[model samples]
Target: MEYSTKETSEKYSNITSLWRANSSSSSVIDAETSPVHVGPQNSLKENDKIEKLFGQPEGVDFKQYSGYVTVDPIAGRALFYYFVESPQDSASKPLVLWLNGGPGCSSLGGGAFGELGPFRVNKDGTLHSNQFSWISEANIIFLESPAGVGFSYTNTSSDYNFSGDSTTARDSYTFLVNWLERFPEYKASDFYLTGESYAGHYVPQLAQLILVHNNHPKKTIISTINLKGLAIGNAYVDFESNMKGTTEYYWSHALISDELYNKIISTCNFSTPSSASKKCNAYLDQIDEEIGNIFLYNIYAPLCNNRSLSSTSISEVDPCLPSYIQSYFNVPEVQKAMHANVTNLPYPWESCNSTLNLSWKDRPLTVLPLLHQLMKSGLRIWLYSGDMDVVVPVTDTRYAIKKLKLPVKTAWHPWYLQGEVGGYVEEYENLTLLTIRGAGHFVPTYQPNRALAFFSHFLSGKLLPKE
Candidate 1:
């Protein structure tokens, strides 16, 4: 789910033209695997259980399932998902769908393993429990959306080239509907959407689409997705605010010079055809020169060692853990356990897909309206940012909220965890602006305990404690 720092303004009207891949790659399909037909209600017994997780860690008592839900079977296209039931009493827990950003990144690899899933993948290719895992509070679902991300693939090659925000939303919704038919027990469960980074665009857009479909004329045919709320962390909500915030964050944090900042802010138009101008790019380059080799997502975190495959201790994961995860997911046993690689995909499992059309034609300049629309629908909306994240920094999140002008329901105050100041928040009508004290772009990975604490509160309709 990675996007270029620059944004493209051209909008393509024809959706079919977007996904034309080289015909040679996916023109064939196996006869045994036919297009899936939606089954009758309560006929979900088949996909309700996961056979194994290969080297699944000890002390895990939860039931988890991993498999593909056919999104467009004509294309033999399917999206992969990893669902973990809450360890203690999932029947009462809400179903939360977690997505990761890169626009093409793997949510299972990033969000599930690296952040809030029940377990984290060790460098040695073993599994370990994540005590702060979000599944501890709710039945978490991690989806590898759009064909070509993670194990999700297409037999019709063109689907790879045709992915964008709209298709992604449509297919993700389709996956949810079909997935429910396979597990009808959760059809009426309250759904809460969560994601970060480029998912800032994905989560809101999907929520907007779900809201629209909730009132479709033929509503009975479509299963009800009881959408209750959404939570986005270090998200890219608004382009102007994000870009302006990036520049301001660099300048304010002494990453850029006063002169360069002044020159770009004046010459660089945030509303450019590509969302960024040449002069703006040049100035950012200068800042890059000064911040050499540091992780932009978590400027203070230690870098991972690629060769030895070591980084942080078991306590905290290295941001580069994605490499280790890539190795882990590609294993035959792991794939078999996860019920993945059904058609023997041509390519290896990757963390960020490069085949996607980077010149996305459907991306909206800003998702602020979608956020507004969701809030107006009486959905619980919480925007949380990791203060240490420079990509979509906390300052920009605050700036975006200020622009929304939601009437303040509670004055700004420190929110506590374990008697310590975890962060600060200002509650607005139907929305909450929150900051995680020491986390980076991926809050769950960086500050797991606090992130889980914050999330537990958000999901339970309880505010972050003031003590």
Candidate 2:
């Protein structure tokens, strides 16, 4: 199902509890009574630092820290984070904050372990180095944001019901403010916001909030955040454009028949997607039927038949990798090492929080306006897509960018990596549009080397290689 449609339907469905049967009562953290704040910032950092993970590989050179930053002390809400400093010259490297979008996904689980952080989980629950890890270019922070995701939690049960875009952005901003206090060394570092999928909303919204905070006349809060730019992959930005693009992409890719495509185009009012006619809903169902059970994220990729270590490989994309990550994080020793699940959450840690995904309260129809505002503020903005991702397909991104109508600064052309065409790039007035060849919904997971290549250029403010 399309991301937006699936979310809307799930929103109205019954809310089933994913918590464990023996779950304990909610635990409240009193801000004043919490010992974490009683000590100096250095001591707090020391408490959060990971001397080593449960199954961490030997000879690992970089430092890793994971802990909670209380975003709402009154509500006892805190966001969980996993931080990895660069392997070499971390002092010189910029800081990159990576988020994953299930609207309620764990950035640590998805972006950190599953995609671009320094390590990947083996099926047997051991850690191996990710050769193309983005940590080579910057200190990466994977945040499980807006309480109720991953290990992030809220004591007030109603907070989950009220979680929305505005609250998330505010809390994430609060996280940065507090996180910087703990790691003041990186406060002056060039900071870039990055994420995939629903983070299309998270990244830009948080950036916009930061820009606004920086411009505040009174300047009551901590010093300004050194936010330099942002980049999103397989983003969900504009609803109408996304719907139109999805239909077109399916037809052009021969996933749907021409007759069905024509009917969908003529009958469905994409602008008012909630009011889809019975015929349109039936047509959409037919599309789902035709697509069958193949992974919609990457239509061409194979599905995980069994969650077995024997079938997994370090150099290849393992469809069952999520299962491995789930298993690894659920281990009691792993939680102790990472300083996660401090309250012993009733539910096991999950990559994506279904409750948050369905109950996301304030998604705007489009974040294009925020992008325009960011561009005007002189921030670097890049929207990229993985050609293989049918969920938030390249066509959808192209259509959304077209709505911005920015004059082209550089004509569209192929970008190269290691003497081969990596993908395509187009530079507009204040933004860049890019595609990663042979990648899917999670670009870094599907095409790590190419993702790293472009990510290096993005951090350095260099153009993608044209040769």
Candidate 3:
């Protein structure tokens, strides 16, 4: 679910509880704290710190992998990603980078747990198998982006609250370059960048930057970005589309009054300025502000409401579910696998570091600016929504996509998973629009089968499955 500035701050305040649950007790830290690490002028130093911080493991565990991936040029942060690795190497197998957008979120949480990660944590704290794991079709990499997220930490206390799309895009680009140096083989594999929520901004911005670099006269031409395409579930792009989607969905679901709907529509046409006016913007703003407290919560209630034994109970108190998952990652065995000492860090695996909270910033309405840059360059892009997501709202995504004005290839139609009508899909010259049925903001964790099928088709460069 999309977090308001207030709720976002509150969420940040309580994130440490899960950290203690996951990390070694010695590493427990307050969310608002930061550490100043000195020296270490090279990647080797960074690597050594990682080893010293987490320690060695007992036996080979399936949930861990060892590697030093960089988020910047000079400094490298450590990462341990979990997925079912392919038995044999094939260049044809695609490598996908998954992102979860919070200006401060860990991809390991959203991309790994919410979307394509291979396992789900049960209510009993045991791992459960995921039938629709995306790794079955592609090699998925989850990064704790920016810095100071998940296992990715930075020395510069200055980097601590730094945020905005430009810095994130640049840092992600740096990661790809340095990560390629660390694991040289996968550089040219068919690559796709996918994420949800704020990733609507993060994915496109990063993809555009990657496309620019690839088109340059560089020796390593990233052949076939397979970039083939990108898709987001319950995306937040256009302000109007998102807000309207919320009200309309509420109306259709009988969550609001037709009289109130008419009042909203007749009063607020958020599409154009000449149409929107200062008065309209004010009214719309008022509606949007109140949404999070009332209707929006109801729409997203099912996500947290499912206290069923069949699903993973990350926790009801922490709005950030990944904190609980971080506790799971703090195991003695997991720490050893990553070569961490466990004694150095003040906390266990953190879904978020309060020090990083200063880095989080609320996104402005600039998707159209980015989308226009993408379309003008002839890149394939897709912006989608989850019908039930009151947070980002389908209306906002629709409004955002409309701004591109690309030539239409296919009109709106249902995109299905298995035999069911999972969501709707639309096609433009170099873009696709999809909507997931019954999904909230975190689509994959809420609806894994549909999410995987969507990515399967995207990575394969084919038309979506028939409903």
Q: Write the residue-wise lDDT of candidate 1 on 1-467 in tens digits.
A: 24221221111101111112111121111112112245343533445467667667766698988888877767888889999999888999999999987677789888888888887787788887788888888998899987888899888877766677777888888888888877778998999999998788888888877777786655567766899999999887766677677778878877678887798678767544344556556665566556566666776877655544554454566655766688888899998888889889888887777546454435555677668777889999999989887778887788788778889999999999898999998899989988889888888888898999999999987888899
For 292-394, candidate 2 gives per-residue lDDT tens digits of: 5656677787766554334345558877777778888889999999999999899988777776766766667778877887889888888888898777789
Best by the TM-score measure: 2
Roughly what TM-score does model 1 have, to 2 decimal places?
0.88
Task: Report the Cα lDDT for candidate 2.
Answer: 0.79
lDDT of each: 0.75, 0.79, 0.55
Best by lDDT: 2
Instruction: Work out the TM-score per prediction.
Output: 0.88, 0.91, 0.74
Tens-place lDDT per residue, model 3, 1-467, is: 23322244224211111111111111111111111122222454234232221322233223333344545434434343332343235445777777776556667655665456765544334454455667777767777666665666655556654555566666676666655544456767767777877677677777776766666554343332445456666665555455566666666766556766777778765443334556545544444343344424226543332452344442221233443465556667655645543335565565555545444543444466666666667555666566666556676677667666677788878866667798888888777887778766676666667777777777665668665
Summing lDDT over every window of 10 consecutive residues in candidate 3, give the lowest-scoring window. Answer: 26-35
1 or 2, greater by TM-score: 2
What is candidate 2's CA lDDT for residue 91?
A: 97
Weakest 10 consecutive residues of candidate 2 by summed lDDT: 12-21
lDDT of 3: 0.55
